[model samples]
Target chain A: MIRKSPMKQENRQTISGADFEEYFQPQNLEKALEIKAEYSDQIEVAAGTTDLLVANYEQLHQIKNWLDLDKIDELRKIEILENELHIGAMVTHLQLMKSDLIKEKLAVLAAAAEDVGSPQIRSRGTIGGNICTSSPAGDLLAPLLSYEASFKLQKAGAERIVRAEDFFTGPKRNLMEADELLTEIIIPLTENEREGAWVKVGRRKALVISTLTLSVVLEFEADKIIEAGIALGSVAPTPIRLWEVGELMLGSSLTELDYKQLGQEVKARINPIDDLRGTREYREDVAADVMVRALNEIERKRG
Target chain B: MQITFTVNGEERELEVTPYTRLLDLLREDLGLTGVKEGCGKGECGACTVIMNGELTASCLVPAPQADQAEILTVEGLGTRDDLHPIQESFVEAGAVQCGYCIPGMILAGKRLLDENPQPTEKEVRYGLSGNICRCTGYAKIIDAVMMAADKLAVEGSDSND
Candidate 1:
């Protein structure tokens, strides 16, 4: 049996099932944004209802009026535009796996989706939820960050694209306002034809929270790496894209020796804290180890 | 809250709590006890059900969330008269020991086979990992999956989808 872990709250909020009411199910993006403008503070938008349930457990009444993003047909689409892959907020992990476009365009994303909680969780969990929730150890964010991802966040009457690098402020902390909802996660569809992979280390495989995870996107010119984008999760306040390490390996032959040193250098970039998953020092060490293993596998496959 | 859904090909409408789980709705309101609640969380696949072509944990799904969705439970998958091939494989392979986890295991296995008709051993193991059996009846269960795969391939009703 899965034990219930208490969350941090000043006082628990309780809403009876009898008190439950479904308020918003906007069919289109415009209507959803209009409702967001109207029901500003009380409304909580949800796609999968996974993260919201966790947050609701923490603060009982945090979800009083639900704006069901799942019902918004426009927000539930996956489109490949001219420059980037545009995945709507309501696109479930299962849908991503079924998309041949995802497999051909972004294989690392498909691999990361495969690592999310389990088959059940994957069916409901969305990439939008993964990014908007801003969990430091979220399975999908590191990979998205590795792809130089951004989000198209829509508010009452306006929208802006925020790069993944500037997306989150801290653990469970995002710049998302009460009125703004994430419409789509945008990843530039690279025509350069590079290969990327995601690796996660958790206690167990299914329904386990990731302890340390890494995503590496490498662009190889002939036999040398022209570009490398590496991101590490569960090692910082937010999942971080390791620009320094990527710059270090920009123009080098990625051998086993180089991978070992890069792992140590990536370790130096994070400030992991002691939490329920692992101690700070343990996370730091495991972060390095997972990175090394991930880099090794990617390099070996590249060869 | 009044909720309506197609359960096991039959349309069902019921009054339930918004917090009331789909598992609870199926067992209590509808009186279909096939869907078990081992872990009242998403971790356990005991409450697994195919909701609109995707297998999901019924425990985490609120009754309101399942409104207007098409759901298939273990009871609906096979009847006493005509059992699903996966169910038949379970019976033929002697996969059921305690029978407590059979419904869930069968549901998970059915979903796996539906998605990947000819899943390898590793794929089968990963698919069934969500459903736990205390009796350690995994070997027979694996055999059942393989047997069902071969049968489905023969029948051509396989999700070749």
Candidate 2:
């Protein structure tokens, strides 16, 4: 017989179940909002429940009420409107990866999502939950911001659309209200002479937060740059579009540019911090490099 | 809460509180102990189960939220008398280590094989990436999943024949 180690046995230990209160599976956003407004902070809105369960285990107690957003039909939808693509908050990464609209219009967004986790995690985790966490290094935020996506947040009595740029306040923080649910992340559906991409350097391939990530969207008019958007993550307090870099790339001859100057402009934009993941200088330097690489790649494609 | 869902093909009702995780509901309330919880958090995939054809961490799923969904725990996949292809491959390839992560790995493999029977080695690896087995170094598990994929494919082909 194989001897099982102590840690393995402990990890395998069957947990004793507990008795708790009732849960409300709200079928619609209205019902979810009603429960949220009624319970206030006590009402936990869960789609995948990945973050919520870890938070609950630390306390090991019964939550009075839960607003199960999984039953909300509208939140699980994906649609393309008049030159716009609207993704419901409950849309999982797996769904996004499989969407032909996303594959064509928002390739960068889908690429960033492919790095989120394993397929199982993709099936369970939602795009909204990533935004709700609102970390400066939120993986999908950079690409979403690059597309200039707008977000529609809804509360019981009020609703608002905020640009993805202004949505986050700080690390793990957002402009969300107590009663509001992140209903949709809205983006343009144009596939002009424009292309975009999301790139990251993480510790490991899977299940690792990005050391730094870049999302670059490019639009051109006959080999001359018409529009450009450059967003950076994990190199600042919040994910942001490097407007100066975008401005530099907007009207330049992207065909065969050396990128030394464009690279310097990007380097001037970010203020990364030193942490266990990497050094500030390293992140900033690598971030500048990633931007340059993305720009050059897009420019080469132009050629 | 009165929760009714198809558990391992049997329609069963479970009276669970809002705070109870699905891992607990399966192990305690329903008395199906094949599901294990290594990490109460989602980081570890020890408590994985099939929820409406999707592989999800039972530790993260709330019990009441599982209502009306078709849930398949490890017990439902197969028995010792008639092992599923994935389960049989695990035994054959010596993939059973401490066996804590086995249930979740097997279920994940089942879900992946069910969806794509001819998945490549990389696909199989990524499919069961959620499940972590500290022992066995993943060689035999990968081999088992590959073997199972072939077995299932052959079986699927045979059934058609």
Candidate 3:
């Protein structure tokens, strides 16, 4: 049931130029899915509303309908069920930083959330929105890709899971259907000891979009690297995982691995472009440099 | 669309368009002009406020989403006659220059102190990093927050006595 607007409005105001024909806030996921299925083409799904209202405010006038998912409490939960950590799509960056569960298991993801825009942005920007926006520079993308997270996309009565690595089609583009809503992100809980780091290079310390971001998560078995996930952002059309580089590190300790060769492989895998934040050559060089430093730091910590 | 929310401890009901921003709603309708609009985008924290006990950029909040929420703008902190501890500390440290960013700075400081009663210099810097001050170079702003933490600590002990 739609909550009716209360009658008593003491301070009534109307913006002249801006208009939205309909605003729907569904209290539950079931109702939200119905609304999305009905108004699939016209409605915009709003979680934190940061990108829609701030980053892309210029396009607000063209938006005719809104499907605000704020009231759906199911999308705001962060829980661990059995061997998986289920993070609701509406979980904000601030929430991720404060979650003890996230800190213990997926600290690298939390670190990325901490590097996101200032306190205000973190408080309002949701991880699901970050994934949906599909911005290559999105702080959470590199870490999410590194963690091998999966997304739960729902429409009407059906839902499907998409791997985080395969969800993005291009910069500012994703594989989400018009009638689908990203409901939760499922990350498998690992029992192995893990060490990781999130490094972001930007113009200024705060409120600066990243020029380049690197996330490396290494699973160690008695100092031997059994599994590794290395990902880079802002160096390609989509955030990419260096599968070949990761393969080279398997079963080899940092001392046994060739740093020079691994760095060269990382540089060769990424396809960067010249933009305002950085030049293609600079990103390529820094990507290699940051990767080595991050891995070295991890090694030093393990020692 | 219509939205109902509490601003600075005062509850009010209002009619707002779907695209109407909380910044405009607070400034134009309620006359809380202390919430400045430096950068309409979320990059600059000049339009920062406390919503649902979280630091938020009012410019980025859609008015419709503010329904049934509690918001605290700079006006809610204190008046000129009786200044909030943060505002007083800013003045004592000469943290205000152009004053366009002070309201947001003051609110950010308040939010920080509310969470962390005793913040270190590094913590203060991290807390105020979101709000940029063009004139004072941020040394004094950091000092003000540190001072406020001390002042609030003393005030809390005195209240107990």
Ranking by TM-score: 3, 2, 1
Q: Any runs in candidate 2 off by more than 4 Å, and if so which?
A: A1-22, A60-62, A296-303
Compute each candidate's TM-score over C-alphas.
Answer: 0.89, 0.90, 0.95
Best by lDDT: 3
Worst 10 residues of 2 chain A by lDDT: A1-10
Q: In model 2, what is chain B's TM-score?
A: 0.96
Residues B1-161, candidate 2: write the lDDT tens digits.
45777888888765555666778778876668888878677766888899999988888877677888899998998889999889999999999978989999999989988888888988988888788887845999989999998998888889998
Q: Residue A60 CA error for candidate 3 (Å)?
A: 2.6
> What does candidate 2's lDDT look like per residue over A1-303, in tens digits?
221112123322333344333367778888777777777776677777766777678553455566778888899888988889999999998888889878888888988888876665777888998888788877889998888999999888888999999998888888888878898999986556777767888876666678998999887677677778789889899998887777766666665565776777778888889998999989878876877788767766555
lDDT, candidate 3, A1-303, per-residue tens: 233333224433333444444788889999999999999878888999888886567566567788999889999999999899999999999999999999999999999999899999999999999999899999999998888999999999999999999998899999999999999999987888899988999998889889999999999888789888999999999999988899999998878987777778899999999999999999999988898888888888787
Model 2, residue B154: what's the lDDT? 88
Q: Write the per-residue lDDT of candidate 3 for residues B54-112, one digit (tens) a residue.
A: 99999998888899999999899899999989899999998888899889888888889
DockQ of each candidate relative to the true complex:
0.27, 0.28, 0.53
lDDT of 1 by residue, A168-279 (tens): 8999888888888899988887657487778888888878888888898887776577778798788899999989888898767666347778779988988889888889
**How far in Å is the alpha carbon of A177 misplaced in model 3?**
1.1
Q: What is the CA-based DockQ of model 3?
A: 0.53
Query: In candidate 1, which residue ranges exceed 4 Å CA deviation?
Result: A1-22, A54-62, A255-257, B154-161
Ranking by DockQ: 3, 2, 1
- Stretches off by above 4 angstroms in model 3 are A1-21
Please report, as a residue range, the 10-residue window in candidate 1 chain B with the lowest summed lDDT.
Answer: B12-21
